[model samples]
Target: MRVKVEDLYFSYPGKDVLKGINLDLKETDIVCVLGPNGSGKSTLVKCIEGLQPPQSGNIIFDGTNSSKLSRIEIARLIGYVPQSSSQLFSASVFDTVMMGRKPHYSWRCSDDDIDIVADVLEQMGLANLSMNEYNCLSGGQQQRVLIARALAQQPELLLLDEPTSALDIAHQLEVMEIIHNSVHKRGIGVLMVIHDLNLASRYADKIIMMKDGIVFACGAPEEIFTKENIEEVYGVEANIFSHEGILSVIPVRRSDAKLVPESLGIF
Candidate 1:
C-alpha cells in the first residue's frame, strides 16, 4: 500500500504537534522517523493510522482518504505495533496472537486464522512459547510476540513505534531482521520510529528527521546523516562514515576541558 500525507497539520488545544508535514511512502520502502523526544514521531504514526484525526490536510492510503474509512477498514491495510507491547492479561501467547485476527473475523476464528497464527509464531521464534504466559516472558520475547501479533493481521502497511527500545542488542537485531524480511517478502511498506541512528542508517531505505514536530530533512541515510544534519537535528556532534556499503554514525563526546593523566614515579 502507498501512503501520502499532504500538508498535514495537527494540534492539541494549545500546542501544534504536526505542522504542515508531507510525505510519500511506497510499498518497497522502509521509512524511519528519526527525532528526539517531543518531535511528534508517535503522533505521525497515529495520524497515518487514523487514530487521531489531523486538524488539517489529508492522509491518503492507496488512493483513498483515510478519514473516510472505518477503523476495521483501516486495519485491513495498516498494522501498528506500539512502543510498549501490551501483556495486560495472563493469556497464553497463542491466544494473544490470535487476537490480531479479530479485524478479519465476524464471530469465530476460522481454520485459516489458526494456521496463520501458528505460522507467525514459528516465524517469530515463539513456537515454544505458544502456551507460555505472555507476562512471564523476557522483554525481548514479549516484543517478538507483539510483533507476531501485528504480522498476523495481514496488513499491507506496518507501522512500528520504537520496536527495539526494550530489547537487548541481539534481540534488537533479530526483530529488525524479521521486520525487514516481512517487508521484502510481502511487499509491505514499513514506517518505524527509532532512536538508534546507526540502526536506522543500516536498515532504513529512507529516513525522515524531525525537529519540534516538523521535518528537518528527508532523504537516504547517506544524505540525511551528515555531520551538519546530525548536529542541527539532534544538537550533538557526530562522525558519519560508511563501512562496507553501510552508513555508520558515531557520536562525538563533548567536554569543557581536556585532562592530563597523572603517573606515579617508580622506585
Candidate 2:
C-alpha cells in the first residue's frame, strides 16, 4: 500500500497541531518520524489511521481518499501499535491476538482466524505463551504479543508509536529487527514515531524530521542525520558518526544558550 498526505492541517481549540504536513509512504519501506515532543508526530499517525480526522486536506491510501472512508474501513487496511501496552485483563495471549481478526469476522472466529493467530504467534516467538495470561508477561514479551496481534490483522500498512520507548537496549533492537524483517519479507509499509536517533538511522529506510508542526527534513538516513539538521530540529549539539555503514548519534549537550520553544513545554 502507498500513503500520500497532502497539505494536511489539524488543530485543537486555540492550537494548530499539524500545519500543511505532507508525507509519502511506500509498502516496502520503513519510515521513521523523529522530532521533539509536541512536534505533531503522534497526531500525524492518528490522522492517517482515521482516529483523529484532519481539519483540512487529504490522506490518500492506495489511491483512495481517506475522508471518504469510515473508521472500520480504514482499520481493515491499517494496523496500529501504540507506544505502550497495559493489559488489565487476564485474557490468554492467543485470545488477545485473535481479537485483531475482528474486522474480518462478522460473527465468531473461524478456522482461518485460528490459523492466522497461530502463525503470527509463531512468527513472534510467542507460541509457547499462547495459553498464558497476557497480563502476566514481561514488558518485552507483552510488546511482542501486541505486535503479533497487529500482524494478525494482515494489514498493508503498520503505524507504530514509539514501539521501543519502554524497552531495554537489547529488546529495543529486537523489536526493531522484527519490524524491519516485516517490511522486507511481508512487503508492508511501516511508519514509526521514534525518539532514538541511532535506532531510526539504523533501521529506517527514510527518516522525517518534524519541528514546530512541519517537516524540517525528509530523506534517507544518511541525508537527514547531518549534525546541522540534528541541532536545528532537536535544539541540541550532537556528533553523528558513521561506522561500518551505520550511523550513531551521540548527543553532547543541550543548546541551553537558546531559548526552548514554547510549544515543547512539558506541561
lDDT of all predictions, in order shown?
0.89, 0.90
Tens-place lDDT digits, model 1, residues 1-267: 889999899998999999999998888799999998988999999899888989999999889999889999998888889887655568999998998898999899999999999999998889999999998988898888888888999999999999999888998899899999988988899999999998899899999999988888999998999988888787777888899989898888432113323353221
Which parts of model 1 have CA positions greater than 4 angstroms off?
254-267
Q: Which candidate is the best by TM-score?
A: 2
Task: Provide the clash count, candidate 1.
Answer: 0
RMSD of 1: 4.8
User: Per-prediction TM-score, please?
Assistant: 0.93, 0.95
Model 1 scores a C-alpha lDDT of: 0.89
**Pairs of residues clashing in candidate 2:** none
